[model samples]
Target: MTRPSPAPLRVLDLTDDLGAHAARLFVGTGADVVRLERAGTGAARSRAEELHWHAGKRVQRIADEAVLDARIAELAAGADVVLESGPTSRLRTPALREADPSVWADVVHVLVTPFGRTGPRRDWLADDVVLSAAGGMAWLGGDPGAAPEPPPRQQAEQLAGAHAAIGAWLALLARDRTGSGQLVEVSAQEAVAATLETGAIAWIHGRSVPGRTSGIYGHVAHRVFPAADGHVAGGYSGSPRMWDDLLAWMVETGEAEDLAEPQWQDGEHRWSGRPHVDEVVARFAARRSVAEIAEQGRTRALPWAEVAPPSRLVENPQLAHRDFMVEIDAPEGRLHDVGLPFESPALPRPVRLAAPADLPAGAGWAQGRAPVTTRVPRPGTPRHGGALEGVRVLDLTWVLAGPYVTKTFADHGAEIVKVESSQRKDPTRFAPGMRLRPGASYDDSGYFLNFNRGKRSLALNLRTSRGQELLRALVPHVDVVVENFSPGVLARWDLAYDQLRDLNPEVVLVSMAGVGQDGPWRSAVTFADTLAAMSGLTYETGSATRPPQGLTFGLGDMVAANAAVAAALERLHRGEGGHVDLSQLEAMAAALGPAALEAELGQTVRPRSTVMRCAGEDRWLAVGACPADELDAAVRALGAGSLADLAAASDADELAGRLQALGVPAYAVRDGHDLVEVDPQLAARGFYTPLDHPIAGPVLHEGLVEHLEATPGALRTPAPLLGQHTEELLTELLGLDPAELNTLHEEGVLQ
Candidate 1:
């Protein structure tokens, strides 16, 4: 049977890396993309190189204002989806939606920027540094006295790009059922902040800033050590078993007599004496090549890998076998880049497009596109059937990573008590896009709403004696307490895990820090999401032609949050109570995954540009998605016609319908419409609800998490107004009488 036609995606391709990457991903996923470019920064070579990002897109250059305005209006009316970077300001989306609400409502508009669309810093100039610094990334990087380093590359921007892509996909999925679309605001700052790993978690628990350190590699027994050949690689000898295996391997190979004590033969014994073990391992490694050591280590199942450079990575065997790199033909030449890592058993390969070579000079580009055709619902509250149901989490996290992990648990089914100090609310409360009026409270921020949903908030002054008493009173009710603070912070607060364990031994505690609890640099440095950039993740991205750019958003923080969630799940599964030290840098380092393995083998890889040109226009094609033997046959699949013509058999709606008929996944890209208009996945999952807000009228909101055949969790009410539940909670949880509550309120203990 013939495959179904592709979907229609409309993108306002601002001349930025984030927007470019978003457009590129959309096209790769079988959407017919239309891109809008302007005159400024229109360098011929730069424009030519855009082909690497615009391969599957049709481009148009905006010239005169009159023509541009008319074309934009026409395009917005016709487009199914809309994506923009710098152009998305408070002024743009609302005005356009008002002009033709029906047409605009059918479009999923994604605004990508350094800050969100409505924050105090929304109008400020931003790239990586500004975003990262404002997002509190710089606060945790390098040494406290040293100049703050931005991510080594353009991280904030790349995170923005990734989120832009994800937000668009999610919006489109939402639109599939509700027959409308909504504006998706993405902030590079918030994205970066979101990836602070456990730093924020510790802030919630310990009220301290997580510090940074040099190349300690985080958690477990990991670090980058010099090999015999003057190359560096990561090695994990922290585990008792791994340490024992390494010693045994050395002894078995007849290389064990370098003056190390015999107690090193046992894993537990060695872990306690890391310094001695390090000295012996360093000496032994001085006589072996990285590859030889790595091979031998792998043979013995010891975690070790050489540090690899970008240029050499293009030919890395494991990555090649996994098809992690793709080559797209562009005007400049073929460009190589990292491809999507997530894969499904059914869909093995995604079609890659090369950017086009040229566009009509001064042609009005923002014209001719179809609108969103589906109306999927928003995702809702957690279901009772989740594995975490009945679990109680004492969420002491602020900012990003810690909050994010706890939020995931809340999304699933855990009851979360998000404890914060009024003196230091989560930065996001004041960071951006808070729909605050002249005298609104902290709850007005969209950032707070987005991450803290379905969680209870408790404002406590942890620095006060009374606050300490309150926490001690509350300890017995919680199953877990998670924090991300600098070393010694919780201990300083007299709330260390040991102290807490004395009160409730069954309670699990997870500590997230920039570095682990033990390391030479543990107290000397700080780190943030940008830690990924410094640890060679960014260096592995972008083209060799330019310095590696940071991912457009705070990916390191996000990845770390996922790791934290996974770790939490693991701990819960074991049903063992202990402290879990999650190092932010270690989590970010782990995202490097196989790359770490290759690095340990003493290989280096290069970061080649993915921007290129195609089809007499500027576009980017996947560098080598078409197999060597199937290139000619695949090219023939384009069917010798304009992309629009190839899609002529049906509009986006009919195409999706046909694809669904064939049991394949497909949907149209859409513009600013409603919360629900084009999300097929949401429809399939039943994840949206129309809720009436006091000010926003009846609007679509995210629905429930997970589907259960039996019992399920439910949200009886939306997040309560600030202080709305104060009385009930105080009366019930604290067993306070009305008169006592009034006295406490008068004493400023409760808001």
Candidate 2:
């Protein structure tokens, strides 16, 4: 029997550059998105920009203001969702619902702006660069002595779009349960602020602020090493095995000099003696090609990656093997762009529809009066429980991406069983110098603590048959299973989606791999830095004159985590579970849609410029496109006759405050330390919550990114110790007897 097609969501997209990616996400997810533009409007700066954002959407131009309002009211009267991205004055949520009460009763309205709808800075004029500076990201890039660099492309705008997508999905889920729609408000500044990695948390709890580095943070050996052909991002930190492997590789190449001494054997000692280790590694790398290092290092589990550019990514072997890039025919020619971040059996493969043909010169306005008839069924109340309250997740993920996804679920009241093994612990647990205090154990690393919060630890060695049985036993009680191992690792242990389905028919399996499950490079190992390089982010992150640099740590991991949450929530709303194959490379690429579109269209992708500078050491600003008068006022407020004079001032924050008070789009560049104690806005909004840890005392945790008034999420517990709840979880969920557990422990199957 032929199955009926899935119902398409009706989405009305009224957004500019700020919300283009959000609308693109809707289109990718099979939404019937209709774009509403002004008649004769030419807002797109270039043809490439126009095609990059507007292609694959049905467009309708409205000439009269009253007619536009009526058209929106008519569309909203039947649409499932309405997305707006301009200022609040242009598209207010209250005004949209008021336009036609009955028709808009159940339509989700999403608002994306620089700030929020109600705030002191709500009406302030800003752009992507300005928002990045305000969010403290700008302050964390570039060299410590140089001006902080803003990430290339519109990252703040793209991040806001990502958050908006998550918010939209959350609202849709809520609507499905209560038969009511809501306003999913997103702030560009706040969205970027939340993804600042460990900087903000460090400042609030550890009283330490992170600064700009040449490459990865924390480790002295983690930096870009110049190779014969290009550069490779070296990530030899966290584990003694990695450090030893790097030294061995160098020794094999005859580059290890005095550094091969027994004194440098310890990972901690090697870090302290990094000058000698770096000298040897750099010499060895300079003699070899990036390909050689990447290929050889991966075989030995060394986290080394070739720094790649967007153009290079176009021909990446791993990405090509996964068919990560989709070829589309455009006016110019055939172009390639990234596809959806994940592939799920329950969701159809996303197809980019061809751009609409040009409208006739005299397109009549009367065509806008068409009646709306489509109506989505009000889904039954969610049986999965209260906003994820009773959901149970089996978290077999480690490090950043997978743990981040489970952390979100845990925050919203999901029970998360974080499975690990003492034999091969999470690298983050042993990350050097990230401990809360000196002489702290593996579980005391701040990096591990931050990501593993609200999870119960269940240490079971998956290598053992009994351990595999124990995991299979618990699968029936879990609503979801998430992991981020290299593609084939889980399947090797018979824990693949196909295997789990026999135990729990409704279980959702989310696998976050660097490439994907069925790709040629599925077995390629990856870290956050390598994923960035492969995804074309590291290529476009730095200044045009300099070699490409990476963004704040684990950018790809964070983006994939957000996408994972949306995917899980979406499946839960549908009341059906299936495999979700999420690629970290694709997730980060999705956030760079604008750049991908431009590159595919053969446009000259220019590097972002550093605009504003402030007085003080390493203080810079990213004041996008401020009005001429406001710029002038800002210069005058600094009491400087010239830019040089402004740069010589003693305090940039004080000057920024004065300019901000004068209604100028300006902000002082802030490092993690600066934001912890100084960001009044984040404090006012309660973006930090204190959680009591048994050993660390009261530690502050980051707050939720999205706000759902009816069911806001919370951080309920601290991070668990290694195997802290193994006995409890085994007894309660798997009904394992004490004798069996003791036997398992004696057999080394359970830690």
Candidate 3:
């Protein structure tokens, strides 16, 4: 299959390390990017960071900011897109528009900042540690009743960069409709908060305030465990079937003890049976090698993986088979870089090029190709309120990761007809955030409500021929089809991408799974918790002294969801049909930033996280990635004796403020209550939007997270009720009459 190339774009990248990932993404998607900055400061901080971020971009540097605005406007004149970010605002679009409105007015310009342009904390001092805490990620990981630790590397900044890419694409799509350029404003803090998943939802929608559980899920052990050869992530205790299978294995091995008791068989009993069950599981794990345990667990269908560090990612079987790790062409020798987050035919490879060579002045990126054309609506055509107004998508997805993809676009006014089943519903419909309203059923779940908003549900049994025919018929009506079933499940039902292509040649198809459509572990039953461990993140999660803790928040969902949305949108922009084969494994691994690149070069893995106690009970402050100059002054300010004693006397907010005053990066970790109620930055951004649900009543939701100056999206409606739009959707999309709808309903194919 020939990979389809993205529409070629010219981008003037006026960003530092914070916006590096966005520029890299642009390059990967066939954009010609010129990295412009002052001469000395333009050099990357480290070698691996340089290779990972700037491999395929052209570089141009000047002595200083003298004539910088003039140069920026000149570059903007030739560019289709302009990108910038900040420790301080670069304000590229405003400056360009100020200088020459006619030239820069129609350019798609994206500006990414730590806190966004309008928020009160927009100018606050921030780094990885400060952003992590303020964004609500630092509140979830680490040990319970202790200071939460930020993830090892550049988690916050990288996530913001990905969101910046999403915003830029959305703007490009809008540009096609509006006949103008755009200002895409992205907030690193909001991007991190948007992906907190249920951590923030547990408070926003439900009254439940979830706290750090160390590495345990309620009463069960949820972290990595020991093996004779090495540690493995093996402490899952969910699902009745998994528990039964595990108990049987334990009993057969003469290690079951009293777990065979009748009461112990109940899942609720097992949840509370943690300490005892944890000891038994640990004992069993200690007796086996990681190889023995992983192999044996695989045959039994357990969510198990060897907890590999960054150094071992290249040798991972699934990754190696998928070619996710590739060598870079550097002047010195062949260096390594983590490959593209997703694999798709017709899309460009995530190349690792060397330091950019100097190009002639006024050199255009390509010989002579017109800018990608835009739709020009004739005079007096009604404008679209949302950028994706006419777009339609058939959503064959459930759970966290898949739902997130549709949710991102649905917010942009894309009409999504979600194909569900009455027989077997999406499990998240019954998961956490269950509202306390009376007479709640499958449709009453807050998890379902938050993720499925602005979607119409069509209940169809794919197991039946009539249902398959209906789905194939509807394929021609939609612009895209997205699904996350295990690899090949669609083929069995005659609904794979090939089948969809037969129905509509111009339809874009996106198939995402844990390990992707092709790989040794393609069919593995997996979840985000296990994907976390397998991505080499879990091995680097905890403090340096302790064994790495499990990542319960499941960041892989957001990573893959963002990539899938960006890829799908880019494909749609070309007005062509293509298939995006995405793997959550590669997606999550790619989010490790430059950690994998460093480890690939044989550098010793850096230590993970830092924690300091502060005033009040269970209160703490997180600080790290501090500059060398600030470290000593920060230490001296705190004075001699334990850090705990010094910080415990000062309020966390006040202490963080003082540190920030000294140019040291620090932030008091905000909890769920604090975030929704008192986080000034969140309030200033209007990040929390209230939605009135038919079942769950009125609740606050994370509305359109990005700021698009031209065509900002809306939370159009609450998530649909199960099978709520069955008849209406059929009639609208398929032109099915009332009689046909009733007949299908009678046959139990449409419910």
lDDT of each: 0.50, 0.71, 0.75
TM-score of each: 0.52, 0.89, 0.93
List model 1 lDDT by residue over 172-266, tens digit each.
43454345566666665545544543334233222333444333332234544557763434344333565566767778767767524666555
Using TM-score as the measure, the top candidate is: 3
Q: Evaluate model 2: give its lDDT.
A: 0.71
Candidate numbers, best lDDT first, in rank order:
3, 2, 1
Which 10-residue window in model 2 sums to the lowest lDDT? Answer: 372-381
Clash statistics: count for each candidate = 146, 0, 3
Candidate 3 Cα outliers beyond 4 Å, as residue runs: 1-7, 42-44, 89-93, 218-222, 235-239, 344-352, 358-369, 376-384, 432-440, 604-611, 624-646, 658-662
Write down the worst ten-residue block by lDDT for model 3. Answer: 375-384
